[model samples]
Target: MDLVLLAIVVGIGVGIVVGALGAGGGILAVPVLVFLLGMPVHSATASSLVIVLITALASLPHHARRKNVDWRNGLVFAGVSVVGAVVGSRLSALVPSQLLLTLFGVMLVAVAVAMLRRALRTRAEERAEAEQALAEDSAAHDPAAHDPAGQEDAEPVATHDDPVLDQPGPDMVDGADGIRHHHGEPEVPLSPAAPAAPRLPLVIGAATLTGFLTGFFGVGGGFIVVPMLVIALGLAMRRASGTSLLVMVVATAASLLARVGTEVQVDWVTTLIFAAGSAVGGMLGGPLSAKARPSTLTLAFSALLGGVAAVTLVQTLLG
Candidate 1:
């Protein structure tokens, strides 16, 4: 029952939770370190950052080794996110812990529901695409599937523009700033449209903000960030997972810096134990996550969020 051994245990437990469930464990780390181990909030916060940082760093290499991460996309998102995280880290000093926890719970639940819906829609679309491909395959295999009408020459339609109505693009139609005026399309198409420029800066800004929340409120923010990437940014599941780990690393790093030179009583042993469990789980989690149906991942994520909220609430109430 040595002190460092105790810290390692806590660390490994937190790691296991993050790897298995992907969030909320980080938040628990601060409180446990402070209460059970008698570390002040400041010291506990810093130490928790160390734990999160190590866990994220360890987990990230696996994603890279598996070639699961899109480096360009992750780096772009991380760049913008650093600024937001710095701002958030500063703000963390001002916000009360109770309020932060409450907000975190609300956000977690909301994001979970949104992701679940998206997973369902993705599944339906995938199924439809599969059926279409099968039908096409059968048609191509059959001798009579092709019709004479399919060989008909189709004429291109002429473009018409209204000088008063449409905005210009490409051509100087009607002298409207040399822009083409293609008619009959939504002014700004929303999500589900064809992939446009990747919003690398915006994604990074979001991650930074999320990082600040992590430092301030002790939230990992992976739950929120992961869904946002999938739904808002249109990133795939593995991509979201990889990007989240990267952002987590930055947030933890900041927290560590924020707590340096403080007399923090870190239960190194506990932390180490938690990190060990998480390391193994992290490796297993990624491939399992990839094979999971989107809907299942979404649903499971929501359930975990709820479970974490319940645990926090109970602890808060009992305390």
Candidate 2:
């Protein structure tokens, strides 16, 4: 097959993977080009960068339209990621690209396993909490028990809807006599925790490292980016996905700029054609993402992560 034709085909595949899984382009792009098409890793990495940049660009306007970019947070992480990518890209020229892929493959597998563990743990916790809530509700509803002074207090931790209280709620316990039985009545004060913006620094650190790997190895960071955002940064799946695409858009652009004068090869024409396909595909993706159920998304994401892990494990051992 012609190299440009091959690249365009791969680009469409990468775009669909990105649209569906939110990250997997470079991993798919590199291995296919290397083993199947016999492209050298170095050239493949450069070519993968082209594919990544184009797909990322294609995905960006959709995310921007959805208002998930969080530019301030994106800027901080993107700045760090750009630096890391430049360093990683420069290093890519010195070290063997094959070695980078092998290392990256391991990293990808490790992240997938970690996320699977976290997802299981989170689901368990949510279930346990729900069960406890049900038990509590049953106890509180008992007709024989006295709820004097509404002592059977049902306190809900403040959410986005209500103002957070500075001081604890009145610390008086309910009395059996339907009133404060005595002056020394003890009340369990509700603990108030501060709500933080989801875009935290530690999460950004993960994003930066993912970008470095993506830019350095020519893989999409979606596997790492989406899970980290959902599990660590507490972003919803759609938001994490949208945010990941934006970050990719920034990181890929920066790396491409660095590679412009380098010895790395890029088929810009092929890359553009692939991106043209992705633009239409991605327009359809954003709305689908918004409509998908969270549970369905999580399960689907878990399956995708499992696949990536299996691919990485096979590739790493083979390499």
Candidate 3:
């Protein structure tokens, strides 16, 4: 009963991280299970996958309702990633547990650094935009700034036959019959043009790499997937976070399926309880995430990843 309670508490924390950032559940879960729960590294990794799978699945509806999930691109990325997941799962078994954990720690540190840099860049961009807006607003209210030549004080010279008014405006063009026509106005409204397709090679490469990491380290791969969706697919941060969850569902499922007959022993009872707590946390996190600034979340999450990585590395080295 005590262990079960602890699992639930841990799950909720992990779930919140996963839901808010659209990743980090598995990254956090594996180490927690190994260090706190005293589970073997292999079992912890396998169990972490289950926890991430459930949390991602649970949080997906919230993002979907917000129209954040890019279904077409997500599906394509997931489909290609499945193949990589299968291959990675097969390779995971041959690697020793110590080396795997070491690699995980190193990967976490690298991801943390990358996220920190991105957060700083986003903050700078936001600050610049705010300054520009403020300047524009000030200029709009200042009459003198707009009329440095003092043209506003000059009297208006109106004429009955103003040549300027008779001339065609920027939107007007002379027709073949020498009649001026409004080129901007159409007889009928045209449908909006379709969005340009994402770069295929980049999508494929990113998906494959994410899938491999998911299967090998029992991660959801959302850390990588979210960035790929944003940079390669041109999705907004919120939408990319949501779409990453969709990709994680598929990747985690594939990785888990590949381990079906493996020797990895999972604590199903504990896993289920943890997943239940995570589901509830995910529900709360979705709305909270919508309210928070993306750069703030990124910076906070990166700090978390760095702390976890440092601890994991220290523990492994001591052992």
Model 1 residue 264 distance off true place after TM-score fit, in angstroms: 6.6
- 186: Cα error in model 1, Å: 28
Q: In candidate 2, which residue pairs clash?
A: 26-219, 26-220
* Model 3 segments more than 4 A misplaced: 144-195
Return the lDDT, model 3, position 43.
Answer: 81
Stretches off by above 4 angstroms in model 2 are 1-13, 36-38, 125-152, 157-192, 195-204, 227-234, 293-319
Query: Clashing pairs in model 3?
Result: none
Best by lDDT: 3
TM-score for all predictions? 0.66, 0.69, 0.84
How many residue pairs clash in all the candidates, one count each?
40, 2, 0
lDDT of 2 by residue, 1-319 (tens): 4766765565565566576545666766666666655667777777777776667667767767765555655555566678767766767777766566677667656665665665566556556656776877787778644557666574542211001111221222245543321123322233335233454666667767876786688766776776666555544455567777777777777776777667877555644665565554555555565565444444555566567656655765675
Candidate 3 lDDT at 236 equals 62
For all candidates in order, the CA lDDT equals 0.56, 0.60, 0.81
Ranking by TM-score, best first? 3, 2, 1
lDDT digits (tens) for residues 41-97 of candidate 1: 544555566666767776777666755455665555555556655565566556565
